[model samples]
Target: MFRILNNSDTFITIGREYVLEKYDKKREEWLHIPLKANIGFQADGMIIDSGSETSFFASFDTFNYNFPKGDYRIIKVLSSEGDGILLYDDFKIDK
Candidate 1:
């Protein structure tokens, strides 16, 4: 799950992408899931309005088939125009 808060008074159009990561025992490293999907607001490719916060829910099934239950991190890539920002770095999912 993710939340976007628009503090500005005007509407904000943003593009978003999500990346999932988990530890790989064999390689002793954290591996990123290959699923590159968009995080939409209200509707697919929709814009968020002023003083509104929106939450996006992502299911494990959306990333892969039969995803293992463990500690995982969700990376949110948010962009407006050509500038991109990475957020929710400390957020983790333990299932």
Candidate 2:
């Protein structure tokens, strides 16, 4: 689960486009991981007024795969009047 806070002065439009990536120490890059197959339906985008916030739930089937314990991040794209901004949040999983 995650929350998106629209602090800008104008309304922001957020889409369902998101990616899950894992950091590879050797390659020094974030590799994309396919995990959306486990999630259910999603809407195209949502408009949030200024000073408003919205939350989204990301459900994954953790039991099906053995994920490595390391740093991961969720990248999201937000736009306002066709201008887009990339946002991300990093997290760690310890088994």
TM-score of each: 0.58, 0.83
Q: What C-alpha lDDT, on a 0 to 100 scale, does residue 26 get in candidate 1?
A: 79
User: Cα lDDT of all candidates, in order?
Assistant: 0.63, 0.81
What are the clash counts of all predictions, listed in order?
Answer: 0, 0
CA shift at 32, candidate 1, in angstroms?
0.9
The residue pairs that clash in candidate 2, if any, are none
Question: Candidate 2: lDDT over CA atoms?
Answer: 0.81
Question: In model 2, which regions exceed 4 Å deviation?
Answer: 35-43, 62-65
Give the Å error, residue 59, model 1.
2.0
Candidate with best lDDT: 2
